[model samples]
Target chain A: MVVMSATTLGTLELAALLTVARLGNDAYGLAVRRDLTERTGRDYSVGAVYTTLQRLEDKGFVTSRASDPLPVRGGRSRRHFTLTGAGAHALREAERHTASIWGGIGTSIRPEPA
Target chain B: MLHVTPRMRDCIGAGARARVTAPRTESPPLPERVLLRLGVDPDFTDAVLGDLAEEYALRALRDGAGTARWWYSREVIRSAPHFLRSSFRYACRYERVRLAAFLGALVLTALAVLITLSARDGPPARLAGASDTVIVNSREPVQLPVQVLDAAGHVLHITGVRYQWVSGAPLHMSAAGRVACEQRGDALVRASFGALRESFLLRCRPIRRFVDWRGGLWLAVGDSAQELPIRAVGVDGTPETMLAGSAIVRDSDIASLRGLRVHPKAPGATLVDVWVGGIVDVIPITVSKRVSTSDALRPFEFFASPLRLSSGQTRRWHIPVGSYFVSFRSDTAASATAAALTLSTVGATCSRFGDAYNYFCLAAKDAALVISAPGGTSGAREFSGYLAVRRN
Candidate 1:
């Protein structure tokens, strides 16, 4: 049987995938949110991070497993996420597509820094 | 260790001062309460509250308790809507499946309860017997009354009845069609007639024969065939006094006891005369002395001293309170002298020698026996003796 490729990732899904990739073995709900805030300079809610991660998992872009409960987290387990091959390919494809679209516009526009 | 700069030291001091002055108020466990009130899924609520509390604690340590509380409140409020929305969506997605499962479980529980009630309250059984347990003597047969009835309380006559023993032996129907128990032990008797059947337990107890002393000479009845056993009941069918060491002569022909000696353990004991096998005999002798608590002690060899005693010297040994029969033997150059020794809480002294010495003494608590050689004796003396203490 022929296997169809997974569909394109949404903005939050792509961001979550990249955050999981950057987090390596430490990718989880709170960790990914922290990394997203650090990179994007915007605090993301824990719900958004978890929901996007769950959607990524459904899209086969990421997989998750529960870690043992930690006392610091009030004895709650961490749902750790990992990027799959599809997720990595999607990231690379999104990057290449963005680069191609930017390649056409190149240096023509200058934006003010925050 | 890294050196602390002046600015860092100042900042640390300020932070310490702030901590020292800050009110030691604990953050109420609000996240858990919020999750409970919102009816969030347990799995998600725990992790969410944990993450919030962990971050809150970190911020509290770094910035201040007030800032930490504000941050935590904002995070909780911002995340509440998202979490609620997601949880609602999840519930909606699986609502049908969960409802189906719950309804299935309810149906199964109702079905189980219905079956149980039906089994318990259904029509009354046709055949029923009285007394699930029947106790009878092994030599005697017990008639178990059985009644057959319809659903309405009317008695139905049984055409034919059959009895069978599920356990034990010699369980049969007598010529009159009654159940006969002839052996000792337990038997499950099941009676069946037509389509109706019922079962009951039969415990055949063996007749106990006892031979004990009673007023005069009386035969006692007991529950066992123990030799010299105290009779639980006398020949007059009255409860007999239980005694220890009472002579029990079972299966004795009284007519042949023309020369039998009736020795009472003590005065005031009544000799009960009973007839066994067409012979007048005294089998159960009820003693007047109630068996004392001290009688619980079995006959035991209390003390046996192999040490030799010299003249004018005494050896004392401690013994518990009880009745003891002591026998002493002394060996001198002339002959081995056997002496009866007596010792009690009160005054009692015996120095006689060269005979069977049987002295029964009642020892008070912490009583000791003092064995001494006669002051006039001057030869080498080796003394050895044993005390037979009677136990209740």
Candidate 2:
């Protein structure tokens, strides 16, 4: 069995994961770029996002398809990528790892249900 | 609601003006649009980006610029929250004003319309015995624009009408026609050239301040000093006083004179009179701003692929009486003449069709012009080609 490690990712890697997960089936280069821009108020390059998407797909985290191009975009085909089950699992594991490390830390507080 | 800083408001207002004035191109790329949509309301986002886009384009056009459109996306990202708050506040205020104005105007207009309908006469005095005011001034010959509708209101295909400035400058004529005027003695005289005939008349009385009444086709030159109070007579020697003023003359204004116009104050008309020492004849008013081709030509039909050109111009090739497609590309410092553009129906090439696409390519800087014909002949007998190239 391939064991999945729970390790906290850096800000950019974590952001990339969150955007892909937020977009779900619609998670593509443009989608992730838009997701990060909306949630974090930041602009990411399409080429950079696409490259990261390929990296995530190689790690068994996402899949992509060449969708029909919009008429106004000079008919450039849109490559739409979707997060896989592995991606969702990794996101959860990353959260758990962060929580475990910060469990005993005094400054970090987790609110209990009312 | 978001508290807008004065600087932000100034930026937004400037952006709006830029959007209104910018020529239609320079829309943001797809990725930028998507990013803009994520943070701000779509309409506000579009408004802000559109303004920025126009500013970018105008700057590019004026400064001979390169692309810096990424600034729009960066700015949107930086100011998303403030923009959303401002947009929401504006929408609320605008809605309240719009509703009140709409309701109030609707009620008042309804009441006024009802009162007007109830007070209508069987025949209004304004319409009674008031002759159809034909606007014709004859002080100077009227210069008509090419392909203007004639007096019968038919589109007269005047492909060629050339005139040289002989004594005084001539005014530009519109799609309708124009009136020429001269103030002889205390009365102002007007004339208009229509269908190869001149209508000369004297202003007998001012009816509607500036409105001229062409009582007849030709109000002959008249004498006001002699025993005849009505000395003005047409070429037929009929005594007639044109109950008109020089105000109906459209497309021309006395640039030097205190008050003078060539055409009726209608839309799409320019009143341009050159200042020549207070003399109306010294100003050439009827100058056509649009340049037309020497001859009209129809494109040959049935081209599988349009011949490609590097002139930074959009090229379209249509199948005769069929749907057509246009392929356009623009680059820095391109020329229509430099492109080895050749169009062929199917794979076969004809000698006559070699120069077809060259004439159709309209040249510009850092922009593309696309035109498609909707499945019909342009009805041109002979087409001449010209290279419309301009170096920046």
Candidate 3:
């Protein structure tokens, strides 16, 4: 465990864990990056995605292992990331926190000035 | 960050981040070196660069090679701040001792600054608005503050000065320079600090409210000068024997002050100012002239003329200031033998007689006298008398 103490996850860290959970066995830095950009409609940098995955791994929310040497990029091992038990709990916590913060806000029209 | 030993890394399985040798190949040399310099984790740096390279190849196939290269460069610059911060974290994880030393130095510098500021006890330039004397009224005691001034002439709250009562009875002050007085007296107060010394006169007086008669003082212009009985009131507001205050007559021509009494010199209007400290009580006196008449013995004016009254009926008179005789006689001689009349002061007897005759020497300034005529049922059916007085 990373320091054996819990670390809080930011938005990007939560999203990376969700992407890793969705990808199942195929989840890696490149696949997570592509999913985040296409789904969020914002191009997240490769560095941003890897930094979040590193943070998630440090929190013990996600664990990473090197895949067999891939044929792409003249034989480089891919760091495939997967959701741990803690990652599933972290995702549920994120959902509840989001709901609590957005619960009482109203979707009403603005009032006219006097 | 995980503090993984080389043995732990080799034996890592599930839940363990398998440390890998990030082979430096196919990644742009300059960008890879820049990522290392910016403090990105070595394995994460490899993963990030490889992902960028893979996306670049795909974008080159879909868009153009020029666009892919430009996009990659833009992405690297946009992501620099995050990479720099991540590198800082990596350095903290590795260099704990160096980081602690830096934080300790920062805290020491802050402590030094605080100590220097607290040690500064600025010297007072002078006393603020020092007056010649401070008067403490017995009613309202004088209140003076020891306000020290800064070099810029601003009044600083009293600090660091020892205020002591050097001499003066019935007056006192606390070490903090608060003054108090109980009775009419004066005190000498001195405050000193370092080489500077300041002194103030603390004078006290008694007299809170008006120190005069209820309706004011009115004394007559007598034939002989009289020592008027004036009242002196204390701070408690009772005008008894409390004579702590001094009374002054404003118009000396009309009335002159002999000790505490006001001796009238002329028939005029004047004011008497009774004061203790600055508090003053005004007494207005009207010394009107006395209406004099002939000194011959005249019949005293009764409420009724001919002095007709039923038996045992009494009458009263407020006699003026004079030496006069109180006498009464029955008009009927038949009833006079059994006739009896009693004339006396309100509380004491002045004169009384039977057999139709009453005479006595009664001298008074301002007094009320009562006289009543009496006849028994067998004596006479009517009883009457005449009362007379002569101004001497």
Candidate 4:
């Protein structure tokens, strides 16, 4: 496949990568907690940004499954998440396209020593 | 019309505590009074409600709403597990010794219950017969005292005896008068002419063949084969009298039967004098090892107070052997000057047909006594009964 170069992607694109890779089908507040902890080596309480998952779902990058009510979790239904094929395609295209643009740099502004 | 007035609004300050110049942590009276009138502000109302609910829950649990409250509090304290974190961080904090001690106590409690049940089914002194009643003869009536007497002239044991006389061979009066068998009410009295006061339990043999023994005779006694053992006694002053006669030795026919023996411990707690005879075997045991208390009586709650033994004073007692059957007797004043008191074991409770005062206790085992008496002046009172050792 011919690699196309692209650069300067939005924060939304990086999030799309995380959702598609680790949380292919079943993901939600808990999955996001695991993914963020794995990627960043630091824990973030997922309660801070569950609304973002809903926003992503609305934007078509992520899909959600309303889970059954759990007793221990205070009868709250978990909204599970999954990244669509379109989401994965967007992420891979972002990565390869970004790498291609970086590869196409003819020369550095600082000239090479003779 | 009733929107919070400016004064009320100002009084209900923001969620944060209002600062004042005073060093003491006292609320300014004017602002406090205003806030009381307005109640809590709506902005901070949710937090206040939450705090009140939490306090209410805590108080309900601490006051003991019962097991359900305790179970709920136990569950709520547990935190959600962090899957990324190691459980060892929490597990290592528990004390090793405390966990082991709890398990050890539970095992000991279970062991104690098992031992108690096993000890309850131990063998009795002896089994007299397979059935409750054994027929001795076929034709004539017979009479014998169900109670047994010790050599010390005390009643030691009591049991029911039945007799059936055959048609042809009636229990006849011998020339010596030492072996005349006759029926007296329920007892078959085999009175010997030479022997002082002793007889044998006569139950008719099925065939009615005359079995001749050297010295003794069988005197069968009972109202009927079905009647229970009658522990008949009469009290005269300090001692209870067993109206029946004592035990005597016949030939091997009655000598081989195991009979109960009574012994008296000397005042200084020394040697014991054996009362009943015909004990072919004797075994001495350490009294300390033999003495035991009933589980129910060990925790008996005794209260001390002045009391009187009324006319209807009666109490049932299940006492052990080697325990003194003590009864308190109130003595009238010797003169007008001094108070006189005396207590004694007033009855013979042994096998020998004599005084069994304080002798109701058995040897090395539990005995059931039904004592009925009026309550008397309560001080620290002590009673001792039978001390049972193995048959020698």
> Which candidate number has the best lDDT?
3
Superposed Cα deviation of residue B378, candidate 4 (Å) = 35
Going through the candidates in order, their DockQ values are: 0.15, 0.01, 0.17, 0.02
Q: What is the per-residue lDDT of model 3 for residues A10-99, given as tens digits with 9 covering 90 to 100?
A: 777777888999999999988998899887788888778877887777777888887776545334568898888878987887788778
TM for every model, in the order presented, reads 0.34, 0.24, 0.34, 0.22
lDDT tens digits by residue: candidate 1, B1-392: 12221211211211121001111333634653554344234445555566676677788889998898888777777777666654454443354344446558979999999997665433335766656866553243555666666676556664456676666656665522365444455677787777777788766543334444332332222212223323443334454342112233332332112223443333122333443212233544432222233224333323334545555567665556665545554444443453322233333233322345545566666566666655444565544444333321
lDDT, candidate 2, A25-51, per-residue tens: 776565576678787786654434543
Report fnat for all candidates as fractions from 0 to 1: 0.39, 0.00, 0.38, 0.00
Q: Write the per-residue lDDT of candidate 4 for residues A12-62, one digit (tens) a residue.
A: 446534754676665656556457667667544332234344344444556
Assess candidate 4 and give its lDDT. 0.34
lDDT: worst 10-residue window of model 4 chain B: B79-88
Residue range B1-392, candidate 2, lDDT tens digits: 12232222322321231112222445554445443332222233333443344444655566644344555455445554444343433334443354357558979999999997765433211111112223332445443322333343444444433322222223333334333433321222232223332222222221112212221111111211111111233323343355222222233231112344132221122233222211222222221111222122122111222223433333442222221222222221246543233332332122221232322233222233232212224332221132331110
lDDT of 3 at B47: 68
lDDT pick, better of 2 and 4: 2
**Which is superior by TM-score, 1 or 4?**
1
Q: How good is chain A of candidate 3, measured by TM-score?
A: 0.83
lDDT of 3: 0.61
Stretches off by above 4 angstroms in model 2 are: A1-9, A107-114, B1-392
Model 3 lDDT tens row, B242-302? 3344678888877888776777776666788766545666777555444433222233221
Alpha-carbon deviation at B119 in model 4, angstroms: 64
Alpha carbon deviation, residue B95, candidate 1 (Å): 6.3
Task: Evaluate candidate 2 and give its CAPRI docking class based on DockQ.
Answer: incorrect
Model 1 lDDT at residue B5: 18
